[model samples]
Target: MFGDPIENPKGWPRVELDEVLDGIDSGKSPVCLSRPATPGEWGVLKLSAVTYGRYNASENKALPEGTAPGQNLEVRPGDLLFSRKNTYSLVGAVVLVRETPKRMLLPDLIFRLRLGEPQMLTASYLHQLLMYPSKRKEVRSLAGGAAGSMPNISKGRLLKLRVEVPPMSLQEEYARVVERLEQHRRLIGAQLHCLEAGLDSLQATAFSARL
Candidate 1:
């Protein structure tokens, strides 16, 4: 999507989020069940399913019997999801869906963003921008609710947020950097797991020797 890669352009233009969104749709609640539903039962997405720049479809809960998910509620890869209501710290979390192994319906408190022109705003780019610490803080500041209850950001206020629109080339570069960093993080995590296993084995060996 890069157009003749320009080097170090001046300031990027700013655009209101509403200008880029075709529509914002919230999810519906499925019947609440004490435990997870079977494969044939309805499954509803949890707000935790979407964290900053990450989507975990597996975090969904199973809905009770006789519950039905709304049409098109199932998340597709590349969909931009936003948390409409949550605790103060998580009120405005956003994420981009990379994959979905099973069909899971979105819950009532999450909003799905449909882009007006997909090419104009890359999902990866937008997700990264929203995940920025400063931007997230700004979002949290906009949230309003009761004195001792969950906070909520209205759709109008959320859509009114101004975002910087950098060149598509730069956005693509940022996406690549994020991908590399994620790969490195995974490698480090694996190494840590191995080290923990080694330590456990050493402890086991020492205990056996004492026996």
Candidate 2:
């Protein structure tokens, strides 16, 4: 039911993504075995790190020493990560890194983007845009191959994609509004979970009394 309220908003700058951001690069695949640290010494993240527009750090794998640096992609907080190859349904999946523990690395299949100007393109706003369904569909349309196993949208193509930008102040305001909504949603979810658990417990007690 959410509509484009920004389309008609005054004082918003309608700009392409390339105009506001830079350093749209993909990660490289490190060699299977190299010198640095073993598989256990380093934390390696794959496409699985991204789920429902959030980064699940717990799913990350630990790499031991001797793993080549080139095999893993280097990413930092504020970078946007996307899955380059996936089925049509899952292609163009995006996640924004809120924070990363020291020396975290991403897998080769993920693309990392660093915003050129924090003021121009707020990470929170861009993260919301990346999770937008329309944007995901647009990216998926650019997917190559008939099998749909490798729906690869190149960095150049991604750079060329257009995005509407609002003023920094407005973006920050919007982010705050979104954050409040998310908080409310989480609260409702928690209440639902508690009710469900209570019901289960009551059912178990009744069964025991009958026995």
Candidate 3:
């Protein structure tokens, strides 16, 4: 139901990213084991988890055995995550967490976006708006770093950047549509996976049987 973000046919009020935020919460980086977290183990979120516009809960490293979990840094359902530092092209990546595995915490390079006005700015809609190709371009321009290093955006710079905010009703509607489309995509992906598996099995049987 939404048009190209930059078009702003709805002509919603525009504001800086921080205008609707109480404050952004950043997590700390801690030494952790290389393996993905096993059930019952606490894990630190990897940057890949929030990259490419998808939240991959499996993309986390286990905390070293017995390391106290950072309770406050845990990723919550419905939290909108933002990558504030990364390679030039991926620095501004963002994702919305639908559900999360137990004990997964945010890392230093990522941010949990906290909305000051949840009534006005829903995480689902904000996630959709931020990932637009046009919006990515604007966000990337805010990143800065020295030569040969990853680009990063300071909270101050992000606060100064502008974004258009549609009315709450339209934003909520957009979120619902996006969720439905996402569900459809996942169903199709599952069907394709099943088909591919069946194909592989049939191919294996045929080749082994010399039919």
Candidate 4:
């Protein structure tokens, strides 16, 4: 985990994405409302959903009425998502969806990554590996678009990228470390929220007393 991912220091077999997966899946992009979808409504995912490593279900637009949602492209928990088009820095952005809301569909700009039969790698480990600085640079190099336009990575070019695949046990071990770090981060976030709430309440009481 400390060395370059592409180096394959562990001596694992490095292969192109096409060899490891059947194919990448993408969705359609229909004209959608500017507002986010409410409960029970259909929505299309926004690029911001994968702009960062974190999955944000709220960064989506409500699908226009009369437009049938793409059931085949609906995102689900444990899915690995990738952005094919975006700013130079985010052209190859990737994210792992831990959980997702119902009735949500992916946009054409985003593709859902699926591992092939034999399940050579875990989703979490793969997601982390892709985000590694060295690997990201390689992924970004595959993007090509006219100047002044958004950089885009074609599915063909992306599939040609070769990556190292470690043993399942090693992948699971790294995933456990990631989960522990996430849990600690969540705990800190909750504590911050409580402290902020208390500060807000205190400020409101102080203002009221002065009135």
The local distance difference test score of each candidate is 0.78, 0.68, 0.87, 0.89
Query: Cα miss at 95, model 2 (Å)?
Result: 1.2
Worst 10 residues of 4 by lDDT: 1-10
List the candidates ranked by lDDT, beginning with the highest. Answer: 4, 3, 1, 2
Report how far residue 22 has shifted in candidate 3, in Å. 2.0
In candidate 4, stretches whose alpha carbon ends up further than 4 angstroms from where it belongs are: none
Cα displacement (angstroms), candidate 4, residue 74, comes to 1.3
lDDT of candidate 1 over 38-73, digit per residue (tens): 676667887778854578776778876566567588
Could you tell me every candidate's TM-score relative to the true structure? Answer: 0.78, 0.71, 0.90, 0.93
lDDT of 4 by residue, 1-211 (tens): 5357867676778889988876799889999999999999999999999898789999999998899988999999988999999998888889998778999898999989899988788888889888988899999999999998999999999898988888789888888998899889889989999999999999998999953
lDDT of 3 by residue, 147-191 (tens): 998999888888787878777888888778888998998899899
Best by TM-score: 4
lDDT of 1 at 80: 91
Put the candidates in TM-score order, highest first. Answer: 4, 3, 1, 2
Best of the two (1, 2) by TM-score:
1
RMSD of 2: 5.5
Which wins on lDDT, candidate 2 or candidate 3? 3
